[model samples]
Target: MNTRTVDARGLEPPEPFERAMEAIADLAPGGEFILLLDRMPQPLLRMLDRDGYRHDARFREDGAVEIRIGRP
Candidate 1:
């Protein structure tokens, strides 16, 4: 599947979330929005869950959090 990535490691508050949300909004059908972060994003995960969006977040071998989001 095609993917759009937002590398948010070391970014300040809101910037990473902003970039991820933007990328998610612009994703093509059947594409994925991948967010790379230093830690898991609880707020984003909650929002996705509350909104019934399909999302998966896992820790990479390097200890980074990788979140994949698909359209609801």
Candidate 2:
């Protein structure tokens, strides 16, 4: 499966979210999107849930987050 990655670590509010939204929009069917962040992206997770998108988030011991997002 093809995968697109967006590293949004250390970015302030809205930029990370915006970049994520853009990357998610451009994902092809059956493709996956990986997002790296410094903190948990609650809003993104919530939106994904509300929109019924397939996604999973993993939290590292170092306080980083990796989210894998897929098409609904």
Candidate 3:
């Protein structure tokens, strides 16, 4: 299936982070989501990992980051 991508550039860091978590929580067992963010807190990343979402995140040249999550 095509992955769902959420661009969080307009949201406040934590707000987007919270929204991402909410979206993940609402997904079915075999869901996939990708999030493009602009500087978020580390705690949020940790929380996401602990919840079983696989992620690939890094700082971008445009001051944004991308995180990918795929359920197994």
What's the ranking of the predictions by TM-score, best on top? 2, 1, 3
Q: After superposition, how far is residue 68 of candidate 3 from its true place, in Å?
A: 0.1
- Error (Å) of candidate 2 at residue 1 is 4.0
Q: Provide the overall lDDT of each model, using Cα atoms, as 2-decimal numbers.
A: 0.85, 0.87, 0.75
Tens digits of per-residue lDDT for model 3, 1-72: 878888877886577877787778766777878788777557767876787666678777888887777665
Best-fitting candidate, measured by lDDT?
2
The true-versus-predicted C-alpha distance at residue 54 of model 3, in Å, is 1.4
> What digit string (tens of lDDT, one per residue) describes model 1 on residues 1-72?
457788999999989889888987787666777889998899999988986678999999999999989885
Tell how far residue 2 is off in model 2, in angstroms.
4.2
TM-scores of the candidates are 0.86, 0.88, 0.74
lDDT of 1 at 36: 95
Model 2 — which ten-residue stretch has the worst lDDT? 23-32
Candidate 3 least-lDDT 10 residues: 36-45
User: What TM-score does model 1 achieve against the real structure?
Assistant: 0.86
Determine which window of 10 residues in candidate 1 has minimal summed lDDT.
24-33
Q: By descending lDDT, how would the candidates be arranged?
A: 2, 1, 3
